[model samples]
Target: RTHLDPSDTLELRSAADARQQWIHYESLTRDLSLSLTEQLRLILAPTLATKMRGDFRTGKRLNIKRIIPYIASQYKRDKIWMRRSVPSKRSYQIMLAVDDSKSMGESGSGSLAFETLVMVSKSLSMLEVGQICVVGFGENVKVAHDFETPFGSDAGPKIFQNFGFEQSRTDVTKLVRESIELFRTARTKTSSSPADLWQMQLIISDGVCDSSEHEPIRRLLREALEERIMMVFVIVDDVRNKKKGESVMDLKEAKFVKDESTGVSKVKVERYLDTFPFQYYLIVSDVKELPGVLATLLRQWFAEVVESSN
Candidate 1:
């Protein structure tokens, strides 16, 4: 959905008013996020309906076998029992890289993307899904918020609102490369990291990438995939075109190959997406649909994490 132009809609007399509005929005977002997360958890990983019961074999329940030994000595807790049905450890980090180039703003798609990011980020934060980071990229990369920032805070949104998308070019390769470095550094600093930690990168864009940067970006993505990092490329398009395939002009439409002794032949193929190493989704720029798509993806992410943990 096209967002109202802040220049035309916002009439703030003072910075305080702006701050108040930001706070109000943040609170509302947090509440919405919490609700969404609860529903998702129920659908994706419902708590076992079976009641907790004492197990004579081994569990949090006192071992009856140890009762005889305990009778002969002072009662003390022992490792004789295990935590029953303990939830698997899932250590994953989520980062969202938003395209903040001028063209994104031209159609007001950028604002819609920002809202989707903010809502999803807040919801994930409320669920405590994983360490989260928000990055905005145009000609340069900007870390709008990181795990250290308080979840559901207005800081990230504020930074996004003030960010100018006047850059002449989009450097997607630089953005991905920098994000890799950031993730590496973060993994080191994180305490009690899980054995099979995974990283999820969500790239929300119009799929506009400079031809010169495509190869490098592709290579970086391949490296990330090799390292078990999951990438989600979300292409925000017009609502009229809800079909999913790929962005037009995402790759060369026709390739000409010359035979050694014959004339050149043009080769046509479907989405060159297979050339890249990531899951791709084409969705309309609707605020409601965007968040639902992200939530569903998160559910799948959790399922994957559970599988990997096992």
Candidate 2:
């Protein structure tokens, strides 16, 4: 129902080119919010208006008010709850583990990763998620920022550049083991255990792990699973078909590979997949889709928590 004025310049060479561009642009704009409810009403009147006015006593009539609540309830059921000690307090902690390897830099993928992380982090802050700690790793791990309070507008780009330096390739096995050990050591050093607080760890990586000498990551993952820690893995790659091409193997395949020489387990492969525990895995072809994907994921997650609270 929305019409484009002839005077509206699409900055294209000709009207034909403009028309073609509009088609693509319109698809993306389908998910965007309209300026006013009247605009939406005008567009839907011809088709949706008739459906909305059908016999309410029958099954065909659409009750907008009831329909909204029903859809909202469905979303609420999909969220995951984080345990907290204080009944009145509503917040959760998120730990981010970002891979900053030489390969990421070479492919110019680090920028994309950084941007995606920044967007997620900022969005979480707006949702009033509690303390957030961002850790960047290559050969070593370093804290980019630990925000007790929400990050400001200038914080994201600054934090991105602060930990943007590239190092050696990523060793998932070693990184997981070391990060877990680091957390335990820090907890011990403080002599304070906040057992009531819920902790969630999220890892962003390309899944191309480092060499075979690294220790098994699976063992650490098993421990995390036993501990009931919430873990998420965001795998960024363009891998479509698994059979015809090389793809990052899931935890099961990544571990317990057979060796023809001595019929022994492949230690390197075992270490990488087993050490890092991931409850949820999200695979995306590119970073451009990350923002929308993350928004939807978080909305689902939060909706559940909100419903449970009520």
Highest TM-score: give the candidate number.
Answer: 1
Query: Tens-digit lDDT track for model 1 on 1-310?
Result: 5586676455433344545655655665665566667665664343454344443345666656667665566654343443456444556588888888896776456655665666667666766656888888888988877866665555654555545567667787888789888888877877745454667788887666654465777789888766666678776664444344433334344445567577767565544544443454545456556556766776776677569767
lDDT of 2 by residue, 112-207 (tens): 455456545654555443566777887888777663535665445445544544677686776676667655544343322354344567788776
Q: What is the C-alpha lDDT of each candidate?
A: 0.65, 0.54
The count of residue-pair clashes in candidate 1 stands at 0
Candidate 1 regions exceeding 4 Å error are: 1-35, 39-85, 88-91, 196-198, 211-215, 240-277, 280-282, 301-310
lDDT (Cα) of model 2 = 0.54
* TM-score of candidate 1 relative to the true fold: 0.68
Off by over 4 Å in 2: 1-87, 147-150, 181-196, 211-215, 238-279, 291-310
lDDT of 1 at 225: 61
